[model samples]
Target: MLYKLNLEHILFLDIETVPQKPNFADLDENTQMMWEQKSQYQRKDEFTPEEFYERAGIWAEFGKIICISVGYFTSKGDSRNFRVTSFYGEELELLKQFKQLLQEHFNQTRHLLCAHNGKEFDFPYIARRMVINGMNLPYKLDLFGKKPWDVPHLDTMELWKFGDYKHFTSLKLLAHVLGIPSPKEDMDGSMVKGVFYEEDDLDRIVSYCELDVVTTAQVFLKLRNEELLSEEEIKKV
Candidate 1:
């Protein structure tokens, strides 16, 4: 079934997020209480809400997207290229730009949004943040009444699971196991919060996000038993 789909119809993407505030104290009293309640199970007695705040970006209610990097395939005769681009800075503005890209270019019954673990994390996170920012959901992100087969989204992690629902795979680990190049040469997801809040390095995060997008595309190609994308075939636009 994967071979039946055109690679050009898929938009591969990855996102980087950070907590809404630099510090736990930066949140209002009510929001802080909400955070404590929301994260209690995960925190247990090992860490306080403040200590667990760095991981708040994992949830849409307490976090904001810092960057969304996307890559799509293009073919010219026998040559194929993957062009990558990113939207970053000012959460609302970037979300608007990403929505515009989906609505204008990728709005079709066949177009798919592909990411690693996208259905569980990236897709819903983007949708929730768009609603929080007062923007209407784009068609691709809006999955209100669509049947499971009608929805056009692909998840590498889900694909890797096959029939095993209990299996969980991180993009980095999957890439390594699949023989795809690692996207975590500089930093991993655990370091994203410090990079954003303390070092103020949006460019670094964008680069990492783009690499993940590229790696995701490569992983998809591998899953389909197709030729892996050479480094020269990837272009940052």
Candidate 2:
């Protein structure tokens, strides 16, 4: 079934997010209370809400997307090129730009949005943040009433599960097991918050996000029994 799909129609992506505020104290009193309540189970006396705040990005209500990097394929005869690009800076603006890209170019029924753990994390995180920012959901991201099979999204982690709903696989583990190059050589998701809030290095995050996008595309190709992308075949634009 994977072989039947057109690779050109799929937009592979990854995102980086950080807490909405630089510090836990930056949130208003009511919001801070809400955060404590929301993260209670996860915190479980192991850490205070302020101490656990570094992981707030995992929850859309308390986080904002800082980067969204995408990659897609183009082929002509025997030659193929994978072009990568990113949208970053100012959460609302980046979301708008990403929405425009989906609505303008990838709006057709045949087009798809693919990410590593997108169905669980990336996809819903983007949708929730869009709503929080007062932006209408784009067609691809709006899945309110669509049937499961009708959705135009692909998840590498879900694909690897192969109906084992209990299975969970991280992108780094999947890439390593599948022999795709590691995207976490420089930094992993754990370091994103510090990079964004303390170091203010969005460029580094964007690069890491793009690497995940490229690695995701490579993983998809591997799933389809297709050739892995050579470094020369990947272009950043």
Poorly placed runs, candidate 2 (over 4 Å): none
lDDT of 2 by residue, 139-172 (tens): 9999989999999999999999999999999888
Per-model lDDT: 0.95, 0.94
In angstroms, how far off is 127's CA in candidate 2? 0.7
Worst 10 residues of 2 by lDDT: 179-188
Candidate 1 wrong stretches, greater than 4 Å: none
C-alpha-based local distance difference test score of model 1 = 0.95
Clashing pairs in 2: none
Please give each candidate's TM-score: 0.98, 0.98
Per-residue lDDT tens digits for candidate 1, residues 1-237, read 988999999999999999999999999999999999999999999999999998999999999999999999999999999999999999999999999999999999999999999999999999999999999999999999999999999999999999899999998888889898664469888999999999999899999899899999999999999999998999999
